[model samples]
Target: MKGIVQLNIVQFSLIYLLLLIILYIMKRSKINQTKLLIVASLRMTVQLVLAGLILTYIFKNPHPIFVIIYLIAMIAFSIRRVLSKNKGINRNFKIALSFSLAISGLFVLSYFVMAVVQVNIFNPQYTIPLAGMIIGNAMTGVTLGMKTFMESIKTQRNKIEALLNLGVTPKKILLPYVNNALETALLPTMNNMLGMGIISLPGMMTGQILSGTLPTTAIMYQIAIMIAICTSVCLTVFSSLHFGYMTLYNKRNQIML
Candidate 1:
């Protein structure tokens, strides 16, 4: 397979016109979000350009320390992003959430890279991109699961209290909310799996193919990535919710909020 053609600066700059079309449509619709759209577009470009430079250096270096640093940075940034949306989370819960994400995400990432891909543990080319995919999906999953679980507990406080009065264990009372949160968190992944290859070419698979990999090989990697993503998401969501719900309780085992 031939290597993909690289996009030059002129070609890249042309892509911004697409954003202009979007802004024009938003204006026509009176959405009042043109400025927000422009800002988001600028942020995306700046972030991606910086990421590309950093990744280039990291890829060339290919050191275990660099890999570890990148992984930690990804986890830290993901935690911050998740918590930013969920204000006033307790310190203990925040710690638990970070722990769950790091442990579950790294475990799945390691297993996929070593057991499935059979690459060097710190191979930058494979590890960094794969880690990004796994951690990125897991972050989204944790965010949805945590937010839904917390909100449900608050909104259904009266029902939870009733169940508590009936001698229902706190764990049992939380089972329904936990179940709902997991479903909400995993639904997007499930839908993607269902539609993959048919409805859309996934980003990873497309990138691989464009980079001169065989379609069959790219498909294999995509399948492995999807499995790793689902496993990491499930583990993170379950662990985070389990530990998080405990924090929502007082010393007397009553609901905190």
Candidate 2:
């Protein structure tokens, strides 16, 4: 196979024309998001470039300590981002979320890296990217699940109270909400699996193909990654929802408002 075609600076710069067109259309529509769009685009460029540099270093070094530390930072950042969206959530709930994400995300990541991909656990080139994908998706799932679960509880307080008064257990009363949250959290991943190859080519597969990997090989890797993502999402959502609801009650079995 021939080497992959490399883009020149001019060619790469042409992509920004699309962003300019978006800006122009937004301006014509009087939407007034020019600054926000510009800032977001700038941040995306800067962050990805920085990540590329860091990842390159990590790949060369291949140190397990660095990999471990990076994973911890990713989890910490994800937990912070998830908790920031919900001001009403307490520190205890934050701890639960951190624990849930760390456990679930790591479990799936370990299985994928060690068993499926069969890469060295400390191999930054393989482990880092796969871990990033799994943890990122799992983080998103936990955020969605936690938000939906809390909202369901808030909106269904009367029903919950009535059920509790009728001698229904708290867990039993919250089962429906748990189910709803899990369904909502997993919907995006499920939809992606359903639409893969038909509706859209996922980023990883596209990257692999661009880097000269065989299409079939890229597809196989994408399938494995997607399955890992789904499993991690399910585990994270279930664990977070199960522990999160417990934070709503006290030792007396009374729900906190």
Candidate maximizing lDDT: 1
lDDT of 2 by residue, 6-46 (tens): 98989988999899789889999999899999999999999
Against the hidden true structure, what lDDT does model 2 obtain?
0.88
lDDT of 1 by residue, 83-103 (tens): 897776888888889999999
Predicted structure 2, TM vs. truth = 0.95
- Model 1 off-target regions past 4 Å? none
Worst 10 residues of 1 by lDDT: 248-257
Which parts of model 2 are misplaced by more than 4 Å? none
Clashing pairs in 1: none
Error of 2 at 61 (Å): 2.5
In angstroms, how far off is 111's CA in candidate 2? 0.8
